[model samples]
Target: MVGRELYRLLQCPTCNSRDLAVYAEYVLCAGCRNQYPIHKGYIDLMPRQTEFDYISKYVSEEESMGEELDYREMAPPLLAAGVRHRQIRRMLELKPTDIVFDNACGNGRFGLWNADAVGLLVGSDPAVLFADQALAEMELAQADSRRLPFVDGAFDKSLSVDVLEHFPRDVIHDYLVETARVLKVGGRVAIFSNTREMSPIQPIINISKRLGKFFVKQGVYDFEREARRKSDHIKDLKTWDDVEAALVEAGLKPVKVVFWNSVFTSFVEHVLMKLGESLIAKRRTAKAASATVLTDEAVNASAGAQREIVARRAMRRHLTKSSPIYWALYTITLLMELDLWLFGWMRTGPYFVLAEKVEGRYVPAPLPAEE
Candidate 1:
């Protein structure tokens, strides 16, 4: 589909030069000679790799583990009502000529899920292996989500799922600014992630760590490591307000904001998750009903009691190490999460956001006077 007139008529997204030319299967910027590979039928215009936050190694390991523990793949039942997925589906309704950007397109999860709908699907990620995987599966470029190589207003719509929460609050603004720069006027971006309050395990994990060593609690904090690995876990997470403010400051109008996956659904998920884990454990335990015993409430309750005792002793060791601010914030977050889960109002699977790029006069810089 990318041919001579198509190549000639299209300017370098980076340089705005009609001097673009097509090579073996790529479009090159005539001014800079930057080669943008054409995978399948789409051109990748990202410049350098540093634009992504570098998660190749982690994602690789995850992919391997994901295969072994196919349990994670069963989440769509819980996420069928995801607001973010709905938003992406809505974006797919745009005209074929409209450009679309899939940021942090890890393994092209969302891109491939909606590929046939959008016209120009540009997928980018930091990890070479991840990009490699995407290219192998569908088509994606090696580019950073943070610093996309596209020219201003390159895409008519963009979508990022399960990405924003992992970044530090400071980096989020840059992400939003970059998204705004790449999207054309009236372009929309839908982001999906967990709100801080929605996850109760975080505070519990932090508290357990502070007291784990001296208190010697054996298994109470078992889920901590697993919880951190979820895409929503952040070193310094943002509240919903902070996220909204960042989007607004980046010159994108907030159209819709919805939260999903609160503790209610979380409880159900946890139970199913434990069932999955038991399936793993029983395969190794023995040839007897011991696995059944392990699954029973009596055994689980006794274990829970022992854990509480250890936790009580351990917590005593860290009596002075309390953060009132963190506790208050997290508690509120928890309450909100609980409300979402129980009331079923705010507990949408994904926070579906619709944002439009702010349009204004594009004043070109004055040309240099002749010497």
Candidate 2:
């Protein structure tokens, strides 16, 4: 059951009120009279409750993302794609009394990773399909970024990781506004998102790029498949200035901004990390293909996503912390950190921002009804 402390923080995602009633199987907001369901502990508090493609992608039919994996473990940097989970955690400077929100908390993994150290970690996202499997330290909610279910000034800190690229261009400001609204005045938010901009030193990056493609041609990595998947959900890769403007409009002042993926990071993430995950994904996909028969639903549904999930799980299984291979790749990741020290000031993609709620500038907006 969801605890009383969480209930005190609950507000109607639609009306933004604390007049909420906790029931056996659902939470009802008296202000809006909207009942959000809780199935075996997964709470769905999204205002619109519309069908979204994220459900298909993140929640595979064969195996869920966190089904067999330890929820608190971070992916080895070589297979983490570009999340920078360790770096993000360091930047947050979490306090024991802090209550943080894992905004757009994909699978609630980050929250799980940090839950024990903080007062509370509430994860809210469009998809809460994975929350049923979540451990007790964190609370997960199915809520929209543009219209959060929490009341005004509810949290001390927020972390928005790998989420901006997925939001549409038009709603980026709305998302920030909601973020600012939920944070107490002077509360900080750690944001990790990408800009459309590429590095000024593109020629140097292309050196590794060429070698990466050569490896792809030799069947060592699926560069084309990775590119397609990377491009699929990216709706808004706004420039850094646009991001700053959006934050200001939302009443969040940028305290620190760091440009990442400059040189070593570009090579490691785009080339090396892709190679590692693709190789693991390929072998795992092949094994699954040979072992299992597909149902009609599997054929019609997001089969590619399911395969990728299986592959990701295999990568985690093999890259256990005790494995020397994990440490070896981690050393490369440590070297990759040099880019942050050397070239972070330069203009480049996937920036990290620490913004503070400035107070009195943003107005909360209602979520549009499902079309």
Candidate 3:
């Protein structure tokens, strides 16, 4: 289980050289004499920490939060994980012989979960701390999205899910260029990202926030802060036109675009999310008040117990047939399915862009057929 496939596929990030040989504890690049360590069964290919401060900070915070919250899980009752995964599979058209790359692959769930379907799957992220689970399934490396560590035309397909939103506006073009650089001709790149437009349920969400403010005054909840923290977007792509232009600038030819997650579904998902947060907060507050003195062990024990409770609650919410949360999620998923079928062409929530790398200018290759 030496991950020989990855050894053959990856290049030295420092020199863009493929003269790599696997040592017992590291990969040695004969061209540049740079040795990258293999820690916890995954390669550390990041040349330096030049552009990953935000990712480092965010991953540190998320690690401290423990395993109670799953970062990959989408908001319940809207945009279910299963639904999204299905859409991704269709968009990428993954094949048994395809070699795929996941850039900015936070947590690496998309590639890890689909390991059986593809020949060689590789996931890279600036934040390597959250990559343990993904490493178990595919070859993972801590590498920058703006400077991918693979040689040119190494991959048959590439994907970036909910990752571009975190990139600064100025560097997005560079990121896309790096993504295109690593893909083989006819290889497609699929991106799911948020734009500047508010979800269709902004008015309802505003009214709900106003009502939630009264709860805050009564010392019952802080829904507004919770919502704001979750909805924070670092970079804004203004519109679909902007997204397309960026891809084109990076030598990618856009082929398809679709907007999904309807207004009604998003509104309901937020309401449920706020309610869940309030409930968890209340429980934590009660536990804090009941404990007269707190020690590190006591705090850890309390957290462990809370995680168990939350996991059980989530299981019931998603699995139990009679549970209201389960039914609500099912009904919303069905409705959203219908919405996509009927009006997905209209501009709405976040959109997915499918594009292919422009090969002629960069390297000679036959033109890809239209989708």
Candidate 4:
């Protein structure tokens, strides 16, 4: 991907000053005199050189242990994709010429999805692996999300998907403030996260996580397996309240926080996770016994089988018995879908909460009721 025009998108990460001068790869902050250097076409915007614990733990250059793990084959949550992309496109409706930032952009997939609408797309992540993944998909600069290498209020739109949970609760406020700082006045941001009250699957997933960790402790699993299965730097499990509070504290106007619900999202997520667990187990044993180099085709085949297993589990969950809480959650989710259908939002999405930033404050609007 070609880098967007430097003059239009460059900003001082610390002071948010437009008085930035760029030469080759270095951007100088006129206000603070802080120097942000560019390396390999990506800028380093961190405040100080400190180790990113999460990146160190989760992203590493090692072969994945396929044993006792299976979530790899699952497609991203369909509902999430629809809602997130729709919100991104909608930001265009709010402001067509906004510079957009995808914070902690894992692989540049979201940036690619929204590439056409935004005036310019900037994706930043601390992990080199994520940057590599993003670069593989499209040209993106390597930078830190916390200390962005752009001017204050330079961007008209920003987004972070499933990223806040990775930080400790105390520091999440700082992240939001930084997000607000980078956004232009009256800019909008879309945040997608998993809330504790949002679904019952959190507990189930947590239990599975513990079980997987137990296996690792017993020497049945390895580091790669753990990294692939669980995140290391995630410090908080946010609920709707926490999300709203963070947004408010950050000084961005909260327009809406819509709860999202869709069969595709839930189904794809559930099935893929089940399969990931299975594949991890299978790979562990298969690799140990075989001395031959593993081919991409072989890995894909393993992932495909795991996908099938996830699909099967999804069907079973919908048809078979579950806990009372699950039934309640399912019923509520179904109701949310029905509401979406009545309002003609299902094709686009449901459970979306929209927010707008006005006068350095977030103003949230109540979710539209089913028509």
lDDT of 3: 0.66
Instruction: Write candidate 3's Cα lDDT for 28-90 as tens digits.
Output: 989888888897747889864345434433455544333323343323323445455656777
Model 4, 1-371: lDDT tens per residue?
A: 43646456666656667787777767687888888776664566665435544343333522332322332222222233545656545544634475788877765667666766656777776653333334544445556666666666767787777676566654566567767777878777887665445343334435545654565566443344324444444536345655666576667657765455433344434443334444544554444423221322224324434333333334334432344634543554444344334433322222344445558344433322322
Ranking by lDDT: 2, 3, 4, 1
Q: Residue by residue across 1-371, what tens digits does model 1's lDDT show?
A: 23332342244545455577677878777787777787553456555322344343344465432322221111120132333454457644666676677887665656655656666666666543332234544555555555566667778888888777667655666677778887888788877665555433334334434443323243323343244346345624346665666677778778776555444334333333333333444344343334433343323333333232233323223333274533443343344345334443443334656677878843322322322
Clashes of each: 5, 0, 0, 40
Model 3: which residue pairs collide? none
Per-model TM values vs. the true structure: 0.58, 0.81, 0.76, 0.60
Residue 102 deviation, candidate 2, in Å? 1.0
Which 10 consecutive residues of model 4 have the lowest summed lDDT? 289-298
Per-residue lDDT value at 88 in model 3: 70
Best by TM-score: 2
Worst 10-residue stretch by lDDT in candidate 3?
292-301
> Of models 1 and 4, which has the larger lDDT?
4
Cα lDDT tens digits, model 2, 56-167, are 2333422333332223344544524334666667778899999898888876766777777789888876654343345354687777777788877889999988788766
